[model samples]
Target: MNVFEVRGGKKLQGEIVPQGAKNEALQIISAVLLTPEEVTINNIPDILDVNLLIELLSEMNVKVNRTSRSTCIFKADDVNIDYLHSPEFKKKSGRLRGSVMLAGAMLARYKKAFIPKPGGDKIGRRRLDTHVIGFQKLGTQLDYNQEDGFFHLTAEELKGTYMLLDEPSVTGTANIVMAATMATGTTTIYNAACEPYLQQLCKMLNRMGAKISGIGSNLLVIEGVDYLGGTTHAMLPDMIEVGSFIGLAAMTKGDITIKNAGINDLGIIPEKFRQLGIAMDFKGDDIHIPSQDSYTIQKYLDGGVLTIYDHPWPGFTPDLLSIVLVTAIQAHGSVLIHQKMFESRLFFVDKLIEMGAQIILCDPHRAVVIGLEREHQLRGITMSSPDIRAGVALLIAALSAEGKSTIQNIEQIDRGYQNIDTRLQALGADIKRVAI
Candidate 1:
């Protein structure tokens, strides 16, 4: 395992560019399987999860050409369908939750797909009910093999139909949309997830000759197409990283400029940080956050404590709630963080409590943070990363603390952020990756 030894109390200053959207890369890369023609993707983030998905594609005999670090050309012309049944395939796909998306693309083109019990951050109960039910609604027959722990889906011919999703699950919606792309009729999906990543998928599919409407809304209409061709697509900058950088700048009193931040697509992220009294300026497509000695949290209009909660797109993202919580530790007032989407995400606050922050763990879903206002600095301690988001949150806390901190299980952090330690080092952060 690799751990990060972060020596805290150093202010960062430099310009850093956010990588391509990790969420969008998962969906878009899977979409290449819908066509046998060459599909070129640009701005791909060099992260663990996305790279694993690409490796899975390569193992399936997709011709992959890496013309640049951030660009790849994939042609699924000679995909080996038999590889899906291989033990190697199962072992690898089991480690990545994004592997579930391959099912929809495979089913759309080959009329069959296999999905192992997917693994990802153990944040909560992430069920496959949404994906399975949506596929069944699209004329796919599902079977489960208990011995191998895989879901088998087969369809002689997919026929599109209307579906009202139980929840606006992002990956579920992406899977169903891909499966419906080559079906026989019109498919209408209501209550669908309209996050920017999903919209990017729809637009990319349209460029590839799939007919999809309602790009930025809950209602999506996809007309079945006979064939899809190849197209080049670029990903938007990762909004989660942008939000994390904003929080990092505030917490450590750093002057950082995030280049090509894709600010318009960020959707309430900057405003949410601003509510915590973090000041920023927009420079073209960049976000400039200056050094701050202290920031104050905003209260509600009625004098109630400000409550930030996660909702669907156009609302605050659940991924950044941890960043918000950690950033508030050094702020001037109190705020309530309600992580409605995942029950266990707030559990990491216990580590912050050990770092001398005033936090109340109201429950599994909510945390109340009384900002220390820089009156007392947090003292670093040994910790372990629980998930991707929480790992970055802990790294942020460690960076702003008073001494050296050792963070174990940094693989979770590498799964999302691209070359995080090297990038932070360029900004004058005293962090090093050590193998243990």
Candidate 2:
């Protein structure tokens, strides 16, 4: 592994072009297995999760070639479905939640899929019920041994119908969309996750000869076809990282600009940041972040103290709660950070507290951040990254601290952000990647 040794207190400046969305790239790569033809993907992120997904694809007999640093061509003309059930596959699946999506892809193409317990941030119970339930609606029979953490699902032909998901589970929504691609009839999915990543999945499927309407809305209408042909598609930019960099530039009192952000697709992320009194000038797709000495947290509607929280799509993403929480520490006023998703995600505030941040960990799920502003700058301290978003949050925190800090468990950060250290270094950030 890799560790980031950052000497904080320097304002990061310059520009960065974000790579493709990690979440989007993961699902699109898996979608290649649905057709026995060459599929080209552009703007693929250079990250661990993408690499792992490519490894899984290779195991399935897909001929994957790295055409460029940020592009790949996948041909699954001779895929072997049994590879999806291997122990190596199972072990690798636990690395991230994206692995769970493979079940739907395998079941759609081979009419059978074997999957082990999926892994991701242990924020709370990341339920698979929505996924299994959706598959069952398409005539899939699910068999499993809970003791061994393996699942086997099979069906002869999938017949789609109207289905309401138990909840708007993001991965579950993506799974159903993948499985519904080649089903026998039309599939209507209500309460679907219309997040940007899922929208990218729909676009890729459409290019692959799957008929899907309602790309960015809750109700998805998918007309399953007999076969899906391969095609080339470009993935979207990472919205979470765009949000992260926005917060980073603000908290450190720096001037920076993000190059070529997919501004039209950001949805409510910019507005969410604006709620905390962070705004920027839009130069086409790039956001110009100016140096600000302080930020005043906006009051809540109906006149109360300010509070920032996370919800499902079109609302703020839970993955960015940590970033938002840490950024709140540098604003001019205090704000309540309510993380409505996971139980243990906010516990890392103690680490920031150790670095002299004024944070009240109200409970397992909430933290009230008292902004330090210019009164106190964080003192550098060694910390371990707990999860993907949290790890980057820690990195952002360390970047603004007053001394040298060593951050371990960088693989957690690597799973999400593509070439994070390299990108940060380009922005004049004093960060170096090295072995611990």
Candidate 3:
């Protein structure tokens, strides 16, 4: 195991660039399987989860060429379908949640797919109902193997149909959309996730010869094409990291500038941090978060306590709620964080409480954070990272605490963020990686 030894109370400065969107990369990289020709992808984040997915693809005989650390050329001309049933495939794919996406691309082109129970962050119940039902609606036959613990999917022929998703799940929508792209007729998906990453997937598919309309809306209509071809794609900057930097700047009283932040694609992330009274300046594609001694939470017009909740696209993202919650620790006022999407994300706040932050975990999905107002500095202690987002949140708290903090299970953090400790060190953060 590896741990991060973060010496807190040192202000970070200098400019940092956010890596390619991890969410977008997962969907985009999986989409490469839809075509046989060379599909070049640029700005791929060099992170664990994405690399695991790429390695899974390579193991399936997808020809992969690394043009650079951020660029790759993939040709899936001769993917070995039998590999999907191999024990090696199950072991590798089971460890990666993104592996489920291969089912959509495989089922669409190969008429068959198999996936074991996928693994990811243990945040809450992330069900595959939407993907399974959507595949069934498209005339696919699904069977479950109890002993092997794999979902077996096969389709003699896929026929496009209408589907109203139970919830607007991003991955579920991407999987269904990929499957629908090659169906025989038109497919319409309502209540689809319209996050920028999903939109990027739709646009990338269109570039690859799939006719998809409603680029930035909940309703998506796809005119099924006989086959998709190869196309080059560039990933958007990771908005989650941009938001994390905003929170980091405020908490550590640091002057940090994030380059190529994809501001327009960030949706409501910047405004949410602004609601926390964190001042920022937008310079073209960059976001500059100025150092601040303290920030105040904004209240409603009628004088109600401010409430920040996660919603679908165009609303505050659930991923950043943890960052927002931690950023408010030294703020001037209080706020309520409602994590409606995930049931167990708020459980990480206990670590912050142990570090001397004032937080009340209302329930599984809600918490109230009363700002410390900088009168008290958080004291560092040993903690373990629970999930990717919460892990980064804990790291942020550790950076702002008064003493040295040891963070274990940092592998969870590396799964999402690319070279986080090294990146933070560039901005003058006192963080180092050490093996246990």
Q: Pick the candidate with the highest lDDT.
A: 1
- How would you encode candidate 2's per-residue C-alpha lDDT over 1-436 as one tens digit per residue? 7799999988889898877988888788888888888999999899888888888888778899998968999998898877777777888888867877788888888899877877877566777899999999999999886766788899999988899987888888999999998899999999999988898889889988899999899999999988888899998888888899999998888788989888988888888788788979899999888888888788867777787788888888888889999998887788888988788899888889999999999999889988887689998999999888999999999999899999999988888887899889888899999985
Give the TM-score of each candidate: 0.99, 0.97, 0.99
TM-score of 2: 0.97
Name the lDDT of candidate 3: 0.94
Q: Which tens-of-lDDT digit does each residue in 1-436 have in candidate 3?
A: 8999999999999999999999999999999999999999999999999999999989999999998989999999999999998889889887788899899999889999997988889899889998999999999999999987788999999998989999999999999999999999999999999999999999999999999999899999999999899999999999999999999999999999999999989888988999999999999999998989889999999989999999998898999999999999999989999999889999999989999999999999999999999999999999999999999999999999999999999989999999999999999999999998
Poorest stretch of ten by lDDT in candidate 2 = 118-127
Steric collisions counted per model = 0, 0, 0
* Tens digit of per-residue lDDT, candidate 1, span 1-436: 7899999999999999999999999999999999999999999999999999999999999999989879999999999988887889899988899999999999999999999888889799888999999999999999999887778899999999999999999999999999999999999999999999999999999999999999899999999999999999999999999999999998899999999999899989999999999999999999999999989999988999999999999888899999999999999999999999888998998999999999999999999999999999999999999999999999999999999999999999999999999999999999999999
- What RMSD value applies to candidate 3? 0.7
Off by over 4 Å in 1: none
Candidate 3 regions exceeding 4 Å error are none
In order, the Cα lDDT scores of the candidates are 0.95, 0.87, 0.94
